[model samples]
Target chain A: MKDPRLLAVCCPDWPVVAACTATGTALHVPVAVVDGNEIVSTSAVARKEGIRRAMRRRAAEAMCPELVTFEHDPQRDARFFEPVAEAVEELAPGIEVVHPGLVAVPARGPVGYFGSAEQAAERIVDHIATHTGTEAQVGAADSLFAATKAAHRNMIVPPGRTPEFLRPLGVHELDAPELVDLLRRLGLKTLGAFADVPENAVATRFGGPATRQHRLARGVPERPLDKRRPAPELAVTETFDEPVERVDAAAFAAKLLSERLHENLAARSLACTRLGIHARTENDEELQRVWRAAEPLTPRGIADRVRWQLDGWLTRERLTSGIRTLTLEPVEVVDGTALQLGLWGHDDERAVRALLHVQGLLGPDGVLTPVIDGGRGPREQVRLVPWGDERTPTRNPDHPWPGRLTRAPATLADDPAALEDENGREVGVTGRLELTAQPKKLTIRGRTREVTAWAGPWPVDERWWAPDRHRAARVQVQADDQAFLLIRRDQRWFLEGVYD
Target chain B: MSRSATASLSELGVNPASELTSTTTDHATGRVLPVRGELAGLLPWGGLRRGSTVSVGGSTSLLLALLAGATADGCWAAVVGLPQLGVLAAAELGVAVQRLALVPRPGSDPGPVIAALLDGIDLVAVACPLPPSLARRLTARARQRKAVLIAFGAWPSPDVELTAESVSWNALDDGAETLRRQQIAVRSGGRGSAGRAKNVLLTFGEEEIELPLVAGGPDRSDEPADAGPDRADELAARRATTREQPA
Candidate 1:
């Protein structure tokens, strides 16, 4: 039997449309969605003013001065297009969303019911336009590529005329721009010229990418739609016969489920990089979370992540009901390589496993990794955050901190101690950021210490523009072999930290 | 020397079997990463032995000084339950910032924590006081995994027990205030080996740490002993530039 005809629906400038519509901007208003510095999509109004996709945002704005700019959010675009996809799904039981603003559906079922492919295409487009308040163009052809290209130009190609329709199209329509550019320089400018090259020659010269492009240029599906398998459920699950209310029980179960999942993945010579742990309570309440690793997850690493997730959900989330089902899904996977140690004894897998296990028991924030950051004070300069978390320091290290101290202390005290003078008078800073008294002594845990040597009161008055301002004078003092950093602020003396 | 002709000849001429056989040398026995120049003479093997425990006492600076070399050499080091560990001091002493992992408080009992760190890390420095039994078990685990365990507080008995004695501050003189130098007297002795007690002097300067030349070792002098990988890279780059320059 002949393959079922395919219908493609596409919405041009969907990101810009979604961004403008979400922000309550009119369609006639100049709008553009930018990814990084480059404009990803431009509205019809903006495009008319000479703004285009792939143009820099600054250049686009230069062309269209009144352009409403938005940072491109693929998640927001997909979220806004869900209703449009659902509208098509209603008419065609099984439709594939190719991307945020495009979808492909087998036309046989919908068109047979609607009497004709053109009638089916019109019905889908009208349903989406009315339901989603977005303009959509639809086309039907024997192959998805032809259908998509037809919708791209707002046309429909008859079943047997797909190749003829694709022939006059530019080689760039094959979507491998690098190969197309090279072929164009060689004077193969049209899809027909690219298609005329033998498949063997394309494979030998340009490899997999060019071969796929050549097939697409021949009006054949890059990969046949029927050859595509439904994405496999790569998750492992454990359904409790009786609900588990205790954290220990859930943690134990998570460990077992994690091992089982890892074993299944390992059998296929794959490793998970991003993992998702899901739990459903007896009352149907669900708790879902995703854990990402700096490196691939080992069996022990997976167990530790799952256990930490369970500990967090059970203790912190405070669910009303007990957990009835638990699932561990590897959201991302890569080919597994042999876990080999270098001659210098650097074993990353073992180290990661150990760290993950520690994180599980101590909580995610228990372990801290230290990074050298630019700041004046010892505590300010060293940034310590929970291990495995990616935190970019909010303060720019490169910015010059005026009146900042030069040397960092050896260690920062967990809590500050009071500083005093030789006469037992408290050392303090005045309203004008001046030291009230010389700091010669420090008292810690009832132990009075006298400084043998001392340095200046370097005043640091910062953030006077803000409501909360910091004003202090720092002094470095040495007592015997130990050195200390003392701060006097607001008529109070505090031991900032110590030198090793 | 056209690119296409050279590539085709190389592809056809290369013997795959000989290449594979030549590359397959047994590297199963993991070697201990060498220590920095300053502390290299202190250890018997010129480095911390893999699958061994070393007891570190006296000061946090000493513990950091011992680790700075191995960590700077690209080994991953994790400091567990060492809350008072001055990470800035470690960075200055020559530990690689990217290779060091700090777990200030690994809970009351850090057995599992230390074990996990030992699995993957080259050196796991644990400062918390653990029970004798637990310490023994962890040491055995370290031996099994071929990882080094550095005990900051105390352990029952370790292969090497290094203590910093007679530490004196030298930079603070006549109200100078800038503590640019320090002198530390380190004593080394351990179990199973000779009870030979050795004393060495370590000088901590602004940029690097060094050891004063002993009576017999005239070649050592006051050279920067703990010069890190940065120096090595600079040397490599200088050598490359020299090679490129015309005579």
Candidate 2:
């Protein structure tokens, strides 16, 4: 079967462009957007100075000493490209964004309207350049993948000649690096050469994924598009009584809407791959953006995308009023079986349901799970995370924390205690780590107990270089059958934990 | 085959005793969650029986130790209203903290919260006090759900009641060294098979020891040994000396 004809719009070095626009850097300046320590994208000027994608930041800096760098942020890229997408959408009504920098639209409508594919491409490119002040290249072919490749080189492939256009392209065009390397080693250096292999041979030799790539090389759709019109009920909408002006409030609403959308999809044995977020402000203005992912989106993934989109709209875009209505729609979906749970362990479905029910009764923070974090004191070592939230420790537990108690107390307490010497004088630690007087009795909450055995004054001088430096001494004292972990600070003794 | 025919066949040759034994064994194994270490001796079923309510009093470490074995074996446990529970100490006692949930503050009434947890979780330990009527209803719900309900304080009536009679710390004297271990004398009493009160001395921290086995009781020799040989030998010597006296 023949693939549908589509037109793709590509913006070269979009990340660099987005970074420049966001920071108001001149377009002619050498700029690079870096992720971690590697340069992910470079401007045209930076490329001329010997800086390339995936190059070390230090090496790039050494090549172009005047280069300006920005940390790679996908939200910023999407925010800056919103205007460009708006420009393309103005010319062609139905456009699907492949990503922040690329978009695709069905070729039939624009081609027929403009009298030819080339004219349509030229018109769209010209419109985007004039409206958004960003240079764009447009190409049309029998498939979106081929059109994307064509757009990169500013070429238009004839409708029936996508395969002929892809023939001389390098195997790297398949975008499967490992498979391309293998194909290169096997002397299949171009798409035509790889496509020349028999379908059965390719299947038997390279397995399933390679078979799909083989079909792509042959210029056919990898899989039959099974686009289904999602049920109207699947779209979750929330109308707030009060307009949401805060980012946190919008994030909370986004989380709820995403969860509801996920539940709706999961109920029908479906998972969304493309999601559309729409919002209506009190000023009667409408905002929309569609996000696409290669894999099906989990609830958390959907929530994060919605949050980022909302953040971009509220902060970056000028709005006369706060958002009044928010909606989350699943634009495309796949089989829910793709979202698999762990097969080995016992199912936590029951516990999760019960905890969620409890959370309903007493907010989200009522139910929590403990995570052991790194610290010297017992209280600082454990952090309680909300039940459904990610379980990440605030501090790394692998660090060697000297002066930490080897034996942790079974119970933590915040009680005030007084230590007295033989003559009923308050006991204190001296500057030289000496005891002013031997502790004989410990009084807690008006109850006096004799101290049988005690250990002392393990001083912890933490953050000594900072202005808010903390200086405290810990002592372990055994009063009869109960042991107390006492901390001395500001000339007062407090009970931190009890060995019960 | 008809019901009467199967009954006639059973009457002719089937051994009813063997059938009863097999059913009882399956029922016991399916209904109980295993508890390891010295604390296992305190329960009548040798583990935590489903639908049963157990009360743990006196020592927080003892409660954490009770949860350690089951949680380590992959059981999910939730603790309600235990804000001061030293989670690090629970980890030290061999509890899998990942499978454990904490509801430090369950609001004014914790009945519904604990009921919800008992319906799904394998075990629900509650420190908040409940009215006698509500406790009874929760016990019934626990039985229906086949989950264990543990009360950290007094309950209406529990299947097993464990109390730490006395506790003493070891390996420290006059600040020379840190505390290394603790010996707790736990006394277990309950209804039915556990009606006869029993006392067992358990050693916690560094090394765990269950000394002076009850006569005719289940032997735990087949359980995997987690302590070193020297520690095991020392425990054995202590066990021998303790066995000479009545427990």
Tell me, by TM-score, which candidate is best: 2
lDDT by residue (A367-428, candidate 2, tens digit) is 88889887767888898887656575756566545445656788998888899999999988
Q: Report the C-alpha lDDT of model 1 over A1-500, residue by residue, as the tens digit.
A: 55746888888888987787779988888899988677889888888898887797888888878899999876567556666766887788656555567777777889789998778888888998888778999888777788889898877788789889989998877655578779989999999988898988976676544665777788875442222211256688899998988768976897679767865765565566667678999889987655544345656667766765565566545579889999888765664431111011223445544555566566556667787775556677678876654444545455544434434455666456677677878766544333466667777666678767765454443332233656556667777567777776655667777765
**Where in model 1 is the C-alpha error above 4 Å?**
A1-22, A25-328, A331-347, A431-434, A456-461, A464-468, B1-30, B166-183, B192-195, B208-247
Model 1 deviation from native, Cα RMSD in Å: 14.8
After TM-score superposition, what is the CA distance of residue B236 in candidate 1 from its true location, in Å? 36
iRMS of every model, one decimal?
A: 11.7, 11.2
In Å, residue A95's CA in model 1 sits off its true spot by: 10
lDDT of 2 by residue, B87-159 (tens): 9888877889988999999999888888889978999998998889999999899989999999998988898
